[model samples]
Target: MGTPFSFDDGTAICLYVINRAPLVEINDEALALHHLSGMGLDPWNPRRMTALRERIHPFGVTLCNNGALSLLTQETQLGWHVPRFISAELAVAQWAREQMGGTEESRNLAEEVEMYLRAWRPHADLIRHPRQRGISGHEHQFDFLQNDELIDVITPHHNATGGLMRKLVDVLNAGDESAPKVRVIVDDRTDPARAGIEMQIIASLAKAMPLSKLLDRVHSGSA
Candidate 1:
């Protein structure tokens, strides 16, 4: 008997009831059949086992070797099923960290940008991280979309902003007349040099509108 093998996909595979019947010792087919029969299942019935696997798939469960079993599910599901496994807040925090690449500073910057946008356009529908299709028919995601504008918040310290900026440019030039106007907000508080580069990229592709300009536009009902 041992702990199951777990995967990041929220699935675990292991011997079933291993404390009593070790998987290695169940060498004979009859023993496997007997073990499955005890659980009210026919070891030879493929359709039944297939149906069972399908039923448990959403819960991240799988069965094998007539006796072995596995459980797979997201962290949220685990927290829900296992009492006191994790607090609701902790689960959400963990999920957010995973989504944001585990960078607290980046997460804070995104939040700041989101808050600013919400305040600026309180009545407009502001979507965070919206997925849209490009000219190539491939889906792409931008940080935020407000009306006819697409906004991205960049951390000056991260060099990946260049690639993201290029993606925005691609989407903008995708021949879609209805494409949103692109804007980027770079936190220039730290690494001002990189922020300058980001600003330049935005300027080259679209208007490198500053935060003040954005606020002004919103106040004047132009955004």
Candidate 2:
């Protein structure tokens, strides 16, 4: 609960406790889409994001500039706000769970990477669900931090593009010297074909690798 930031996509919340009050936020809502259907929900769609803002309004959560929900409490209320925070998490999680149809796929992929790291990268220090602000002032929430590189696990089969812009902007903001290298580890267990478009596009901005081939790439020192 005191962790800096932990993204539980299944619950659609990231807990970042700064000072004493806990700030809970939703990361990359676009991760909700699962298909390329013209009728599919963008999740980051103006309507949905707006609706989320309105929904959280009654709970007194702050609406972030990036169109996400965050619960900010006064320091004096912390001692009595535990229940309120749980309520907020449940409310947001229910709505987000519906959008992404649960995070089973990504959870499976995470487990795989975790096992591999436990076996081969035992000595490697790993930071999961890292949230960092880019030079452009935009924030990026990545899945893992390993080998000094920022890594993300994406199932980008349904996005047209916007869900990726945050990372793209983060990269452009890197400037020449401290440029961050992003690795998109995809959950290709479903259909490798579906990940092609987004993967190719993302590769132009970041490194794209499939979960199946992850061990090989890392073992070969190319990841």
Candidate 3:
């Protein structure tokens, strides 16, 4: 998590991109680079990507490793998806932020992930911070919603997870006969033992998914 370069001017977040086929990023390359963490990228050297190129890990890594965007929306990923008919510039900005993250990043992980999901599936009916009434006639607040799914985001900081289990249990118990599907997006960086125990408690009433796998859950069609 340490910053590797100073003149990076806050660029160089690792991205998973396809290789250029002469004129397009249409094919996947071999695994090579992911630059979010510190290793040995010399900031003052004036030479950057040649070194990054020499160190290229491959497709799962990075090839075109260094550059700046004139505007966030101008950035691209996965080829043909960019500026297709009915294209979304906002989606491109979100993709750019995910790839070339800023120096002063947002601390709101829930909001961040919500935006990520929206960008990837802009046409989906995704609602944020929605309130639904439980069967007990009490209202339950959720971080996100889609169809009948309820997602509650919990973190591993400053007791952020405290009472989440109980609150969710109440919601689950009060759910209707069919019961809406509930998912708890837990921060993956939590302590091992605590996460194990917490996940078990959550699993009894809902799906306990790690923060890192949010998109995976979406892709799996169970988000």
Give TM per candidate.
Answer: 0.48, 0.58, 0.44
RMSD to native for every prediction? 15.6, 8.4, 18.0
lDDT digits (tens) for residues 89-124 of candidate 2: 455544544444444555666667767654556677
Winner on TM-score between 1 and 3 is 1
True-vs-predicted CA distance for residue 141, candidate 1, Å:
1.0
Candidate number achieving the greatest TM-score relative to the actual structure: 2
Where is model 3 more than 4 Å wrong at Cα?
A: 1-107, 119-122, 157-159, 190-193, 215-223
Model 3, 95-180: lDDT tens digits are 32333223124236667778766764667788875665544444555667966677776654323343455456556676467767
The lDDT leader among the candidates is 2
